[model samples]
Every structure is written in structure tokens, then in C-alpha cells.
Target: MTVGPTSSTWTIQTRPPWFFRRVVTNAAAGGSVYLADLVTPRGMTVVVEPAKISFSTVAFNLIVEVDLSGVGRVDDVGIKSDYIGNHGYLSWVELNGTHVVRSPIVLFIASPRT
Candidate 1:
């Protein structure tokens, strides 16, 4: 389904506070990583970018990981790479812990549909 900028609801999931902290830390350190949701099969694609104020070459990957405990099945997951430039990477995994699925998370990061 195509999402508009003003859409109130988003399939995008959110992770717990602690886990989010860890993700932030990792991104700040310029680590190329993936954000996974424990509840849902689909998750956000993350890419870390260096901040202008930093001298250590640290980048921030601001991908939000959703919590899917109360949800049901995940049909499909995808992203648009151009949304956040060339650094974004989106992915997902099955809840059964048997399969790893990767897709573009940001759809037209440069031009999100309004």
C-alpha cells in the first residue's frame, strides 16, 4: 500500500526504549546495521550518516524499529533507497526465526508522496 505523508497510521513499527537506545548508539558510531522488530516480520531499513559537527567520522542511522507483539502476520515489506540518500538499507526477518528478508525501507525518501 502506498503511504501519504499526512497518513495518521503507518505500518512502521516501534521498538522498546532500551533497544532504541542501543540502536541510537550504534548509529552514532557509524555502524552499518539493521533494525529488527520482535513482533512483526517487517522492519525498518536503517542507514547511518555522519554529522557535520563530529570529527571522529561518526554517523547517525535513524531507523525506527517497530514492536509487533500484538500484531498478526506480515504480508510484505519494502523500502525506497533514494529517500535518505545512498546510505539507507532496510530489512526484515520472520518471527519464527528461520528466515531473513531484506528490502528497501524508505520509498522515495527524496520525494515522499503527499
Candidate 2:
């Protein structure tokens, strides 16, 4: 795990059983995406339920879907539109319904630390 959105906040880093490692704060009358750094693995016991993000520069195509439900296990969710004039083209990412295979899409993990 390695979500991004630094400078204002929005960072998630995990490796093992997906413990806890969070930091997201992009203000602008917008907030709610927290999960401090806990990195579990010693005894393994994590429970973080926090996810709420609404960001869109207005150009279409900025999909973020995070529903960890509990525990840990999120593989291959994609979205990457280099900085330029984005034309939009990332049309799939289903986590609990199958169809998952796309990488390089930064920003958007709403919640996943349980």
C-alpha cells in the first residue's frame, strides 16, 4: 500500500498484514480521512474505520473507491493521468465484484486500515 497526496495530506503506507499508517488532510472546507501511523505486526490487531474524500478539479474522471470493510487485502486498483491536460481514460476498478488490474493512480483510498 502506498497512496499519495502529500503537501496538504493524504498518505497511506502499509506492507505486512496491513496494520496502520495514515495521514490525510487536504483542507478547503474538506476533511475526514484519518488513520495515524501504527504499522502493526507484533501481535496483529488493527481496526481503523475512516474514509471520506471529495476532490475534483473539474475535468471529469477521478474515481476513488475504498471499502476495506475490515482486515486487509487490496491489490491492483488503477488510475494515473499524468500532469498535462488529462483526456480521461481509466474506466475500471471493482474490488468486491472482481475485475481488478490497473496500477499507477495516485490519490484516493478513502479508508483501509483494519
Candidate 3:
């Protein structure tokens, strides 16, 4: 999602099923970078548990590992960044399909709407 600082804080959120790689390019004037958070969907709970993110803005190639735990429902994911007050805007967020699986802790069944 194309994003500029929505507020003084540098936090951005996206749709659920957060299994993607995030790339915020053109991070000029001290952009933001922090742990990635998931917005749990209704009827779903955090299963994998969120992971803390550590990113270095020195070069921007630093890879960050974030964990998402949930099932049954899909919700928007909020991303946090250490560097705030950034003049730059957000660029892209790609999902990592390698780990997009149902949580072992929660068993979900999709029900059709009448």
C-alpha cells in the first residue's frame, strides 16, 4: 500500500492473511521500521504469536523476520517502525507464502452464508 505518515507515528496496516514480504522503499529522511503486527480477524485468535522485528536502515537490504499466529478469521496487520517522523512514504508489502498455513492450535471450518 502507498503510505505516507498518517500521523506523527509511523505505523501502517494492511489486510489479513499476512504472509508477505514487506518492502518500504524510498524511505527518505529517517523513515519508520519496527515489528510487524497482525490484525486478527473476527472469531480467530493469535496462534503463531507475533514476532519482534529488527531492521537496520543503514542500507535497507536488511531482512526482517516476523511471525503471525491466528486462525478462523482474517484481519488487517499493523506494522511498526523504529524510525518515525519520516518524510518518505510506504511502497510495497509482499506476502511470504512459505508459512501461510492454518494454525496447529486452532481448527477452523468455513461456513457458507445463507
Each model's TM-score?
A: 0.19, 0.19, 0.27
User: What lDDT does each candidate get?
Assistant: 0.28, 0.28, 0.29
Backbone collisions counted per model: 12, 2, 12
- TM-score, cand. 1: 0.19
Candidate 3: misplaced stretches above 4 Å? 1-19, 24-26, 30-33, 45-50, 62-110
* Candidate achieving the largest lDDT: 3
* 12-40: candidate 2 lDDT, tens digit per residue: 34333333333322322322222222232
- Show the lowest summed lDDT stretch of 10 residues, model 3: 97-106
Q: List CA RMSD, all candidates.
A: 16.4, 15.9, 15.3
Per-residue lDDT of model 1, residues 15-90, tens digit only: 3211211132221333233324222223333332211111132454233432222112122234444343222322
Residue 8 displacement (Å), model 2 = 15
lDDT of 3 by residue, 1-114 (tens): 222222232122222534323332323333334433344433334322224332334334333322333333222212233321212122122243121211112213322344
> What's model 1's lDDT at 69?
21
